[model samples]
Target: MSGGGPSRRVRADAERSTARILEAAEDVLAADPNAPLERIADAAGVARATVHRRFSSRTALLDALAAQLNERYVRALAETRVTTAPPLVALQRLTETVFNLKLSHRFAVQLDAAVTPEVLAGLDLLFARLRDAGVITALDPVWCRRVYLALLHEAHDLPADSPVLTALSAGSEVEARINLLVDTVIGALGGTDTTNGLLVRSVRTSASDDRT
Candidate 1:
């Protein structure tokens, strides 16, 4: 005589526990890839048995971590308007959003997760559009995508104490790095910096027009 579903409160508690465990795992494992579940549970403020209940094994936890990050990446693409915005604007915004994600999950990103081709399908389409529009050089979209991703990984590998970060206050450090990343990506893919200048002008004009 019961609806065959868990109570709403039970579902809410499960969701919170899962989120906490994932966040803690990302931080703990990043600091020590060899970190045990006990440590992660401590970081998450949960019982050690709870971690096991949530993820059957280390491998399972790692897979979940990868899946969570992929979901976040897809969300990032949508939130940044990658599919619908102007190519230049979309590319820059996507790059900025991904830069933060990669850095935030630096260790988890290095794991050999089963990331599907569909996870990157949106980016591939965007790159093709940019190439066709002459926004980028005559390189193949696939190559461009590879170059862009490699650059992002390199940026993620940069140490927190690197001179580039150390030279600026915390508030400005991320901005400076992202600016450098965007410029370098455009240059590497045979796009001109002048287009960026144009993008800036267009954005300002669009904002002004919107207010009228």
Candidate 2:
């Protein structure tokens, strides 16, 4: 007798299709946050009914997206050596890794996902490690973490054709982005800036900036 191989194969295929839909949703929503579900299904090369079968509703779709992201976030934090790595190194690694996670999910392109308490608790634990390691002091560790994440989203959320985004797309882009972010972090922490560090210009904006 067969070990129900066909049923197992069909289940695996369904799982992969669901994953494909989620990934496409992320890319599509990143570009057009209000993109329709039909667009996402088109991007994934799946039928609209398949999207419905998998996600049921926008809320369900978003839930799946957030769940996938939570897994990635937990895995990322586990890999980052906040307590052992050098301050700047840890900062760079964590910022890049976390920002990449934001990019990797449909539900959090703006880093506005419905963060669960477990995730926030995990962040607090990481910040405590940084404080104990003397990587950061004076500044509240929670605030420091927020600043890093804000810097990441602000810089990366720019339009694809934005000059800042274009320049950052050149060689060693992640390194360049990390340098600017780390410099901002160091400055905010009242630490001395490194010699030969990137000198990012201060940005100024007001209500009018949003009207542009």
Candidate 3:
């Protein structure tokens, strides 16, 4: 007469194994976009049988990966210390974090194609928070999520040798690009001027300092 639940330790171990699998999958997929489950299992130091037992199929694995990514995004949004930051600043941070994660974890490629309805629901929850916080304008949450996904897809497609990606690998250029893009998008939504004076000024200052 047991309750319908696994023991706590068993549950914990299962969760831990799942996390490891997801981490390994992200690494393998980043290196090779079409990484197989056996390869992911090998990278995670687990058996192929175990990987199949856990994920059941490629689609299941991708669905789990999408859930994991959305969970990470939600956690980042919760922990971000943006109480006093302007809407644009918060949006910039959110976009940069998402872009970086997508670039680093190739699981993002599958997100757009195989994301489950549950994952979209989770994203809607996060988007509600962003909307409540005024981080984005009052647009349809579904549309906003689609737009975010599109931007991430574009960022993920950037070649590793591209100047933007190179700068992202090197320093704060990714953050700068996120800020520029966010400001531009927000300005368009708000019907305001989108020419960013601060960026132009910073570029000029850097050039002037270089000459000295």
TM agreement with the true structure for every prediction = 0.81, 0.75, 0.63
lDDT of each: 0.74, 0.65, 0.62
Candidate 2 weakest ten by summed lDDT: 199-208
Model 1 per-residue lDDT tens digits across residues 152-193: 777656776787545533245565555555566777788775
Give me the overall lDDT of model 3. 0.62
| lDDT for each residue of candidate 2 in 1-212, tens digit (9 for 90 to 100) | 87999999999999999989988998888888789899999999999999999988987887788777777776666666544544345455666777666556635644446466666665666666656666456447677667766776665564556555445423455545555566656666555543234322111122123225
RMSD of 2: 9.2
Choose 1 or 3, whichever is better by TM-score. Answer: 1
Q: Which pairs of residues collide in model 3?
A: none
Query: lDDT at 31 for candidate 3?
Result: 79
Ranking, lDDT, top scorer first: 1, 2, 3
TM-score, candidate number 1: 0.81
